[model samples]
Target: MIGFMPMLSKELRELGSSLKILYIPIVFTLLTIMQPVTLKMLPTLLKDASNLPEGTIIQIPDPSVIDVMGSLLPKFGSLGSIIIILIIMGEIAGERASGVMAMVFAKPISYVGYFAAKLIAGSLLVIVSLFAGMIISSYYTEIMFDKVDWLDAMLGTLLYVPYILMTVAITLCCSAFMKSQVGAGGVAFVLYLVLTMVPQYLGSFFRKVSPSHLVDTASNVIMGVADTHIVAPLVGTLVLCSVFIAAGMLLLRRQEV
Candidate 1:
């Protein structure tokens, strides 16, 4: 069995040339920059919100920068996660559709190795980009908001990896088992949206575990709370992701290629 680290490195290397990889830097920068920029502009955004007719006045609750960062963090996480999944599914199916899998198979790589590479590659790209964004955002926050609550921001930011990885894992399973790039991409995207919607519409006390709500909900845990109510949902997400990965691998192994 290939060790996960080498597999991860190999996937990261392939990511360098992929057009999809380009989105990572962009999304990362945006997520990193979003909190600072939005914090600076919230008063203005609220002012705009207040101008609306009766009952539309959103109370500009005096949210500290840390509070804003907590919310913004997840939004950024979701954006990066979705884009990665779409690209992964398309790439996997595209290779198969174009007969490029023949070239991939001709190499010494095993089916399991190839699948491992694809999943790890997708996860690494999202995690690195997410880290970059978080680091940059922290830099700006510290420089400008000297009193900003560092502990809270850090807590809010740390859960990013686990949540994003689970999301990507589910998507990779979809991509791997899919027969056509379009078929894979389309099904994955729809499933992604549906997963996202469940947490949004259905009630969940533990925000972290809710598939649809994880990214945005992740920020709640960053508020210095020792235990979040969403652990159930987060655990469910992890379980689902593992199931998807195993299923995807089974499907990939069964393919004629």
Candidate 2:
């Protein structure tokens, strides 16, 4: 228990030093801020592009705050997730290749403690980054559009947390097995696409099990589109994270460090 604290602190410091801590959240916030502005100006932008007859009237409904906020998940599901994967995809595998893992494990650290510390630190970083983006987004959303219900945003954010953590866990799991960080990144990205996109067309049963459902569920909450039961997807995501973490631990144990 005492040893875990330093490991966690070390991981936190590593995350703090990483540029992704700044840039990734900034990307999300920028996406949020731009959504309402883009929607409001879409008619004008389209009209200018259309080069319609002179004095042509372009009519488009102003987007609701809910719509703006709801659009966030898809942007995040696509680009934001990719950025996160790229940032963390190297974490474990890169350290291993550089002999950092070998040096650390040579000491008396518990493998479980090391793994848990990494997971906790990574999860905390994701939560903080997501919150930073959401807070900035909410401010811009309210100013550019209408005030979104804070309660709805909070609920939506809670629902979305697991999916992001799951991505980190997947990358770490892949990193543990792959000798090359680039290979880990590629495998994680491919798996991410499969998990997030493939489930859409499958069926209700797949939707219930898919982590993508968590993002969709969050969007639904933000849009006031009514809630679906999230217990399955949420639990499934948690279970999947645990499994991935365990897999990484097992792979690390087998490796000659």
Q: List candidate 2 stretches off by more than 4 Å.
A: 48-50
Q: Encode model 2's per-residue lDDT on 1-257: one tens digit a residue.
A: 33577899898787668765677677777755666668777997998799698988988878777888888766667677777788777777888899898888877787777777877887777787788887787777788788888788878887899899889988888887888899999999998888777877899877787898888888888777774777878887788778888898788677776
Candidate 2 lands at a TM-score of 0.91
Could you tell me every candidate's TM-score relative to the true structure? 0.77, 0.91
- Candidate lDDT (C-alpha), each: 0.67, 0.80
Best model number under lDDT: 2
Q: What tens digits encode model 1's per-residue C-alpha lDDT throughout 73-161?
A: 75565566667666577656677878887777776666777778778777767777776777677667667554556666555555556
> The CA-based lDDT of model 1 is what?
0.67
RMSD (Cα, Å) for all candidates, in order, is 4.5, 2.0
Model 1 residue 248 CA deviation (Å) reads 1.1
Per-residue lDDT value at 210 in model 1: 68
Pairs that collide in candidate 1 are 196-212, 206-229, 206-230, 207-230, 209-233, 209-234
